[model samples]
Target: MPLSEFDIIARYFAQATPGREDVVLGIGDDAALIDPPAGQQLVVAIDTLVAGVHFPLETDPYDIGWKALAVNLSDLAAMGAQPAWLTLALTLEHNDDDWLAAFSRGLADLAGEYGIQLVGGDTTRGPLTVTVQVAGYLPPGQALTRKGATPGDEIWVSGTLGDAALGLRIAQGQLQADDSVKATLCRRLNRPEPRLALGIALRDVASSCIDISDGLLADLGHLCAAADCGASLHCADLPLSSAARELMSADSGLGDLPLTGGDDYELCFTAAASRHGAIQSLATQLDCPLSCIGLVEAENDIHCHDPDGQIRNISGHGYRHFNESN
Candidate 1:
């Protein structure tokens, strides 16, 4: 007989990891309890991904589960927060044992890697949707934020941009994807590694930080608005993987993905030029790539510096909830 849902929770989800004493209630409990460290504040974020909406229907169950949790972790990473506990609200149109097994394994792998505990949640019948609510804790006065950037701060992004966007294009068959670039870009899109350690290292160093769920320019613009600053990004300085650029050079429409595509989940942040050396060392230790893409400017005039210092306008090219215009 297949294991019952509750037994599955007890066997897998309830086991405690080392250094995770704060999860007072897990699995069977009506609600999980998290006792955060004293003098620390908790940060929270929630995200939802809908099947056939946010993801292609053919998307792998393992990747779906991994991404659901990873995107939430990226939010915590943005705040330089240590992951605490999570609650899931899962809806399934139909139940399949094999599918659940793969999804569970994927979620467990990522949770174990990050020391995050799965506490309590609701499982119900509906159109496929997964909602994750994550909590993280950070020391007072040191949590990173979007509003801390100043005009003189340097803008930086970790990891290659536009791969996920390109991956989507390939997945949709809008573009033919072959060769090493296709394989690399598809992998990046399928499995994005949230820069949690990078976020921790960036605490007190970066003036502002946000994970790139929206396009880089759009997400960075959010930071600018929150920080009351503007940005001037050099096109040459924006970090693009050879895979992404090569793919894009073949098709110009894909170029907008970096400015408009969503789902890369890398960190977009700003720090003072003085801290670049330290941040560089940290990025190296973490084995994460960090690139200086631009600089914060005085106000809302975002100057995209291409050759000849021309100010290119990248307007309305970001992810929007009601963005049916595309």
Candidate 2:
């Protein structure tokens, strides 16, 4: 006998993550009741992942579950919010007990790590899709945004770029790598770490901030547009993982991936040049790599510069949903 919708919810998701004090009502309720922290502002974000569109059709259920929640958390992180609650709406082609168990486990593990509770959501039968909504809190008037950047502000990014894009290529058989490299890249594509701590620490230090979901160029372009400014990126300063560098050394054409690749999930932010020491200290304390790759410019155009300071024309503006070229 197959499990009913209510049965499935009770068994697989009702107690997936531990309860939170802020959650006055959780899974069994028609709608969750949350008590926001005193004097704090609420931040909510939602993302949808379709099996064939957001991830490969053959991807593991566990990874799909993890990535779905992780992507939404990344949005909250970008806003310098402390995650509090999550709501999941799962759509499955059919019920599979094993698949449900693994998926719930994946979602619960990450939620527990972040001290977030599963609140309320819905389940339905349809094409494989996962939608996750996360709510977080931030001190009133202290959230980071993308509009405060100004000319001469330094541009920075957390961690390396292009690994996820490389991973996608490897997954689709468009690229090849040794076993170790393959695992490293593919793990990045499947399991991305949201930089929540860094985002929180940057509250007053960063003038503007955004995460690198789309490729650096495209996302940075959005940031620039928000601030009504432009930027100049130093090609020599772009960070790359050892795996990406090694692969690029073998195939020079692959060098462009870091500039145009998406799914890095790291934060791209801007701060005054005067805050360099403070930002460096924060990086050391967190032990996370933060690279200053460029400077916001008064000219309203994004430009790329080679090592010797010559202008170079790079193609593409990262991933676009309905651009038709992707």
> Which candidate has the highest TM-score of all?
2
Candidate 2 to truth, TM? 0.98
Give the poorly placed runs of model 2, Cα more than 4 Å off.
none
Q: How accurate is candidate 1 locally (lDDT)?
A: 0.83
- Extract clashing residue pairs from model 2: none
Per-residue alpha-carbon lDDT of candidate 1 for residues 106-163, written as tens digits (9 for 90 to 100):
7777878988887887777789998988888899888888888888899999998888
Model 1 Cα displacement at 199 (Å)?
A: 0.7
TM match of model 1 to true structure:
0.93
For model 1, the superposed segments whose C-alpha errors exceed 4 Å read: 1-19
- Model 1, position 287, has a per-residue lDDT of 91
